[model samples]
Target: MTLSPAVDAWAEEEPGAATDRSGWPGGIPSRVVRPRAVIEVQQLLAEAYRTRTPVIPRGAGSGLAAGAVGVEGAILLDLSALDRILELDADEQLARVEPGVITADLDAAASAHGLMYAPDPGSVGISTIGGNIATNAGGLRGAKYGVTRDHVLALDVVLADGSLVRVGRDTIKGVTGYDLVSLFTGSEGTLGVVVGATVRLIPRPARTATAAAYFADIATAARAVTAITRSGVRPAVLEILDGRTLAAIDDLEGTALRERGDALVVIQTDGYGAEEELEVLTSAIAALATDVQTATDAAASDALLFARRRALPALEALGRVLIEDIAVPRKRLAEAVDGISDIAQEEGVDIFVFGHAGDGNLHPIIVTERGAADDPVPDAAASAAERIFALALELGGTITAEHGVGRLKKEWALRELGPEVHALQWRLKEAFDSRGILNPGSSL
Candidate 1:
């Protein structure tokens, strides 16, 4: 491959850059280029566009959806070198950053100014801000703080044809034209490469109260969640884990969580009225839970939150895991949990349930016997996933809550989106990249 002198950047042909955290086996790309400047990105995109070559934009590559998996004969654009917090205006309560800025780094920086970046996905520590925007990523705080899209104020994107266009305003509120900021936010790099972003931040909470409740089963824990939500106390974080998940965590961490109960509900209330909110939440949860434990200090609070964070890793220790994300109406959360349990039993597969129960976004992970990393996912697990997706739709929810439909879920996404909407989305992509480049074969 040849490049113009104006676009001075090193290209790596190594196979390591061709893969991401997604188990999808991506073909070796022609080259992986890390551009240090916006002009270099534009130049590279322009050259790729002229040659009609596929260009895949990538950040920290922590995505679960294989959205950044490299394709054969493609140019993998690694944007990690562009990590720079260009501006942090405490008065304006916003920060402007390059695409490679780590999400946690930004949050820490904001915290110094008594503010916080609220879109904390599970991969926040390692995931980049640009990647978060790509999926509109959500975390435990989503029920209260919203997702990446809620914080993003503007984006500087480089179109497939190499045009640099800035969409959205820096101010808090604006509706001058079409909401392109939102349109491109969750487009999953299919529309364009996000070179930079301006994201809003809010004042950090003064205090937080954390608590954990144990229930006889997941369904009961889910009911407690519903009760808490209806009790008029909005928690900063609300998460749930099933019996299998709790046992796995206990085995891995040497904790006796399973002995206490078959299910766990972790809640955190924040801001000035955090204690008062906790009083209400504890009262509601205690009515349904067999046991309740409240944190007495910051360390204890983190210890309680650790269980939710370790749920996936704990399950991974048991065997190969196929994690699924889905969301249903909050009122029907218990129904969804029961339906998942039924699916697992019918399929004769081990499906561990956990997720942001407050918002109905559940992660029903299917575990199979240990196998090679490259081995295909079991057919039974795939069938169970389809059934779960159907269940979510049947309950007036979505096939996906936060994770974008990368190559892994594109077919199911098309079914959920319907043919007419899918056609319009394709046309929209054409309007942005007529050559059909830019993260081809992924995210619609």
Candidate 2:
């Protein structure tokens, strides 16, 4: 396929070349297109559509799954160059930003005006707002504020035919048409490429408190998460780490969990100087924990929270990581944890588990030694990964809770969604992308 002259001049044709390595899983894309503006993206997309080339729309590439990993002949549209907070409406509590604006940057900007974006993925520091919107990412705050889809008010998307279409309304509430915004949020670029977005923001909390609790077993810790949910006390962030994950974190941070407990539950709550709200949450946590430690100040609380957010990256350094986002009923969290443990043991793989326990979304990362890459072990890892996903399905849970069905999970997506739903998804894809050129092999 012949690329446009301008696109050819701007695109990087080197295989496995990426500006940032942290975001990509297996490696970088085969070709990278760094478009400075939406029109440039339009030109590139037009060429790709005409040539029938697979195009992978990439933001920060900080996704846990290999969502941004490019195929042999695919083009990686790196949107990082489009980073811009185009507009901020304080009165409306909404912000319009280009695809490449870093998630944390927007949050910091909003916070300066006494507002905050709620959907914060662990990689918020570097993950782009477009990526967050595409994946409908959920972080620690999800328990209280909900996922990316909840805050996204509107989106400006580039269709498969190089046409631009705006979906949803900037207003607080509107039911004028189909909820296409919701459809694209977690579509993983299969339906269309997001060029820009309008996200809702909430007032910045005046005060916040953090507490960490230790449990003798993972089951106890899982129960504590359920207890918090059952109690109707919503925390801004709630996280749990298994013994293996704790060890990985200690190795990375050069610190211990004080109690060396089998499991640890970290909870944070925020509001308008609601110390009493925090107190009640901490008290309930203490009831289910062997040892509870509450942070007295913001700095200390942030430190603890940082550790939880860094768990995935820290564990990844030890080995090749396969991150799984599986979620089940809150009350059945223990069963899910036990089932994962059983799978890990049966597969003879070292698995580290951690995630937003408040919402029952657990990320089980399978870490294999770097040496495993040279032998048949990678195959073993792949097989074990499949089994883990199947286990989640068997438990009546989703194979993916927040991380969307990227390339790695596409096969299982069909299994999870079934034939009827899968066919309908295909129909939707055809409607939006008749040529089947936009982000092939993703989601549907």
Candidate 3:
């Protein structure tokens, strides 16, 4: 089980090996291989497959899910070294990128060509494109722009047998075969390693506007979100935050959020219809708000949107947070939120709620004591998370709107997928990786 000096040098369990942002200090790997080229990946996988070694493909490791945590005696594929933008076809509005390219970096590059990558996950700043595709991550703007899967056109995958195979079509409208692009996109590396990808880009919005609608109650704020959605006003982004989250945000920036309201809705309108759409949504929201204020200028708009984006970070200040990505019908968001709040009380956990209300995706971040992550008060946090998932399911919502079913949520995934479909998923896993060498303990 000896690797070449260069291979070992490139990916040894040395001092340079970085721990991911996930903060899950789990198992130590037999080897951490950073492939410089596709051939290197092919060679590594070929040997691993022959030896029946476990391999886990990893990117920037911004994932909170334990999906990429290396198994003992496994080979951890560090894809960050493969970062590259192979091609950007502005005319076709497509970008060919290596797996390790940072998500936000691709968006920035696309913006330069008058195009923009659609998915804007919270960790876009450092998360990899391959990781996003692996999770099909949703963003604040997912209500309108959709998730990472919607933009993925094709993929270059390295299979367990060390074969470099291409799945999916480069064109936008291709249904010639099974949709492997979509299939593999959210497979979370259990099936294969995504070496490269062709991603679709949309035209950048011509203009953008934002408004903050404040409500005395969370139900009213959610009702405003539903009304805005039903009013034919397609806001680029619509977010709602509970009073606790709003108060924390004010403390973070000295904003008057706590003084203004207990709950707030932040809406952003974009494209050529930016102003017109905002006008309609704002009017609708005002009818139900204790006070509604549209950002009078672009600076103010940016501030409002920035505040909404800061929800997760502000919550982190209180304690270690287990952020939940659950989504229900937009009409049922307030009910779901209320039930989530009840769970916090029942479980004796501090829960701050916020998310894209337009699409019904909510983040119920469970906060616990800082150092408690190792072993303190696990019951309360665990119970809160479980109840949140159960409540989401009862409300006809998914346990995870965007986050993949990693090691953390595998149990819930089993409950959600059921036996028949779960068995089919296992067949798919077997079809691509019969030996179970690729991402063992991931996906199915």
Candidate 4:
């Protein structure tokens, strides 16, 4: 394939050298294209499609799945420069934003208008809105407001042929065509590149409260999470951190929690003047907790909630982390947590478990020392992750609840979806990208 001079010239203008390597597992792309405008993105995609060259759409590169990893000969389409808030319709509670806007930046901007974009991925500070849309990311707030797909009202996508198509509607009601917006939300760049999005926002809650509870065993905490759901109390966020995870965080952040408890649950409730509502919910959660402590104010509550957000980074400090995202029926959370512990024991690997307990989504992080990628432990960790994923399937859960099936989980995705559904997904991919040059080997 001949590289167009225009493409080469555009690559030269990128901020960093095209071949700059990342500490991430896969190496960087041979060329990086940072388009300053949507039209430039279209031109880049057109060139790549014409030449049948691989192109990986990257946001902040904060993704754990290595979905942003570039192929050896691929072009890295860095969309971070397209950061712009095109519009904010306060009356409609929706905001139109460029793909490269940081997740936290959107949230902050929304908050200024007394509204919020609910999905709060851990890397919100650095992860781009486009990445969240690509993966249909979920977070602590997902229990209350749902994931990225739930809030997305519309999307402006650039297809494989460099043609732009708008999907979904800004209005609340519309059934004009297939739910392409939802379909592309979690396509992980295989279907198309998201250039901009109109996302729904909710009014900022007037009051908030949080409670921390300790359990003697992880299963006991898992049961409490089930109880909270059964009680019909929707928390803003419900998180669980096992002893190992707490210890890891303590070691990294100098905040001790493992010593005080074997398992921890952090629950928060927020809404319009939700103090009373939160207190009621806390009372119900306290009934299922061993040592329950409720925070009187938002400041204290945020401090407690910070532990969940810091869990992954804390584990990363210990060594390499193979983070797994598994979700099961909310009622079967205990079984899922127990299954993880069983896998850890059988594999004899150090694993830290934590995540959004409210949605039954658990992140079991397998940690091995840096530079130990070839060690037996890393292999054991991978085996453990596979076991945990299989267990989630057996329990009628999903292999990936939030994180997309990047190259790392592609093989397992076949197992999770079965042959029929998998083939159908491929057909859909072909329909959208006939030449199959878009983020090949990712998702379906």
Candidate 5:
């Protein structure tokens, strides 16, 4: 097939730094394409589509699930080179950016104008806006500001056939067409390639307050989470760490958190209305927690939040970990925690649990000793994860809350959706990519 010299210039044989943090099972791509412009991306896709070569859109390589893991002889479309903030209109409270723009970089730019981009995944420092949109990511602030879908105003997508289509609106409200923006937000690159997005931003809050609430046990802490949201206290950040997680923090070099309590709940209230919000949160939490320690300053709040920030890394220090992101109804969080602990005990697996408790989203890490390179995930570890997935579904919860259903959880996701619904999703996929060239074998 004939191609533009510019598109051919984008090819590289080696994956380079793009594969550094990915869980891409060593499936080497035939070529990695790093297009710098939308037209180049279109040309590359057009050739790949005509050639019937599989293509996987990739950004940052920070994804935990193997969503970016490619099939043999595939073309990995590396978007990082396309990073550019095309426009930022403070008056419109809107920003137009290419797919490769880092999430935190955009937020920092927005902050200069007293505006904020809200869908912050834990890996916001390195995760890309395109990846966030693909996953519909959520974070600590998600309890109030919502996820990526909430902030995305519109998207410019490249379909499998190399046609570019713009969907959604810049205005906050519009019923002009079918909600294609929502349809592609969490599609995981299957339906189309998201090349650009117009995102909504919110005004920055003026004042804020924080508190670290201590609970006798996880169930009590979990119960307070249910109460805080229902009590009309909209906390900007509400995180929880169980006893095991606290122990990990204690073991972390230069940290002293275990002495505080077996279960810890960190809360932050922001905005001009923060004073009243802080009072409501503290009062509601004080009723349940053994003691509620309010932060006297931002430093204190940071100290309180430090343990949560280090939870996953601290667990990773022990060994390899498969983090699970399952969320149940807020009322059932205590039960979910208990059920997860029970699974760990039965499976002989070491599991550390913690997450954004305000929304009942939990990240239960299944810890195991590190194995040799190229070794598949251990059978015992895989079985334990399956059990956890089963428990979440039994409790009327989703298998994934913020994380997309990548290669790791695709089978379980199919089980969760059942046959008819799963088939319907495929029909949509077929309508978009009839040859199944886009990120095949990922979330349906």
Candidate 6:
């Protein structure tokens, strides 16, 4: 298992080498390899290919799904050491960066030029660009600017056999060939490892407005979301939090949010007409909301957004959490939330619902009593999660919105994709990696 000199190796005993943020323990790998350059990655992969050894690609291990989990007798390829911003072209409105560059770092770098990298997942501060691309990660601004796939202009990928090839063009518009750039963007490392990427950036919004609307329940808040969506205001961030989530946050942060209402909608509008958009957003939801509060300054705006961002952490503070991501059609968003409440009651578990309401992506987090760090998910929680997935599919939505299927949602993903499309996907996987050495059995 000798790797290139440019690659750093760690024995299986090294802490945190075999798992990811999913809190699932992937079997200990034979070793962990951190490659500093593309050639190093290529060399390591070539050897792994020749030996038919499994290789799992990982960024910062911030993935919620088990996408980056290591396998027994496999090689864990860590790309964090390759962190670098290769180029930032303001005139072209694009930036070329190594896969390991943190998502927030790129946005910060772009901000200096009055531009921003739009795909800001919740883990932006810790997650890498490569990982975001792998999952097609979405975030608060997803309703407006879209996700990782929308921002990615091109990619430098190391194929399963250790060949380096580029996909996509640097230009904004291209239809010369198959959309391989997209194919690889959300492939979850089953196809290839992203070594470097050229991503598109957008100008930073000149103005911004924020507002918080409280409602009696999440379903009601969801109805308000539908109204805002239909109003044609196009808010930059539209998020919702349920009663349980509000209570949890209040308990953890000593905030009186739960006292105000059982559910909340936090909205932020940006760009030159941000103030005008905010007015439309508030007006659309005013009648339905128990109370509506708008921010008058930047500090007040961040204060409103902070609670929405803290939803996950507050839930985590209560106990072990199984965070699930599902998206339904915007019109059915309220139905989806109501169905989830029903599922929670039937399963006798506490499920806190929240997410990017503007785009119909919901995070229904199932919380259980705290136990061992590696404890298996309880049967009730698992059953509740399965039903949630079924509901998402029943409502013409997906089992996963931003989180890649990885190892967690494979069964449901199969049900969602159906046999014919699943077979076609397998054929595509076979075409890319015949030996099945690249993150095998982790995604697709």
Candidate that would win on lDDT: 6
Tens digits of lDDT, candidate 5, 105-157: 99999999999998768898999999999888899888888889989999999
Please list all clashing residue pairs in model 5, or write none if there are none. Answer: none
Model 4 CA deviation exceeding 4 Å by range = 1-24, 372-377
lDDT against the true structure, per candidate, is 0.89, 0.80, 0.85, 0.83, 0.84, 0.91
Tens digits of per-residue lDDT for model 2 on 1-444?
334454433234544433223233343445677777788777778878888887888887677666766666677887888899999999999999998999999999999899999897888898898888888899888888999999998999998778888999999899998999999998888888899999998999888888888888889999888778866678888889988888777888887873558898888888864567667777776766888777857898987776687688688789767677898777888988898888788878888788888788988888787653324436656777788788778878888988878766888999999999999989999998888877776676
Taking all chains together, the TM-score of candidate 3 against the true structure is 0.95
Number of the top-ranking candidate, with TM-score as the measure: 6
Across 1-444, the per-residue lDDT of candidate 3 in tens digits comes to 434456554234443333344445546778788777888888889999999999989888888677787677888888888899999999999999999999999999999999999898889898999899888888878878988989999999999999999988778898887889999988999999999999999999888878888898898888888899888878878889999999888888778786888899988889888888888888877778887777646788888887787888888887788878889999998899889888988888899999888789998988888883335437888888888999988999888888787777888988888898899999999999999998887666
Q: Which is the better candidate, 2 or 6, if ranked by TM-score?
A: 6
RMSD of each: 1.9, 2.7, 2.1, 3.0, 2.0, 1.2
Candidate 4 — which pairs collide? none
lDDT of 6: 0.91
For residue 91, model 5's alpha carbon misses the true position, in angstroms, by 0.8
User: Model 6 — which ten-residue stretch has the worst lDDT?
Assistant: 3-12
Measured with C-alpha atoms, the lDDT of residue 276 in candidate 3 is: 83
Off by over 4 Å in 3: 1-25
lDDT string for model 4 (324-392, tens) is 888999889889888888898999998888989888898888887787333343578778888998999
User: Candidate 1 lDDT, tens digit per residue, 218-291?
Assistant: 88898898899889988889999999999999999999999999999999999888888898999987878988
lDDT score for residue 407 of model 4: 72
Give the runs in model 2 whose Cα sits over 4 Å from its true position: 1-31, 258-260, 371-377
Candidate 1 Cα errors over 4 Å, as ranges: 1-13
Q: Per-residue lDDT tens digits of candidate 6, residues 1-444?
A: 455674665644567877787877788888888987788899889988999999999999999889989788989899998899999999999999999999999999999999999987999999999999999999999988888899998999999999999999999999998999999988999999999999999999888899999999888988999899889889889999998898899889999998778899999999888988899889998899998889857899999998888899999999999989999999999899999999999999999999998889999999999998678999999999999999999999999999999999898888999999999999999999999999987867
- Model 3 residue 288 distance off true place after TM-score fit, in angstroms: 1.1
Worst 10 residues of 5 by lDDT: 15-24
Candidate 5 residues lying further than 4 Å off, grouped into runs, are 1-26
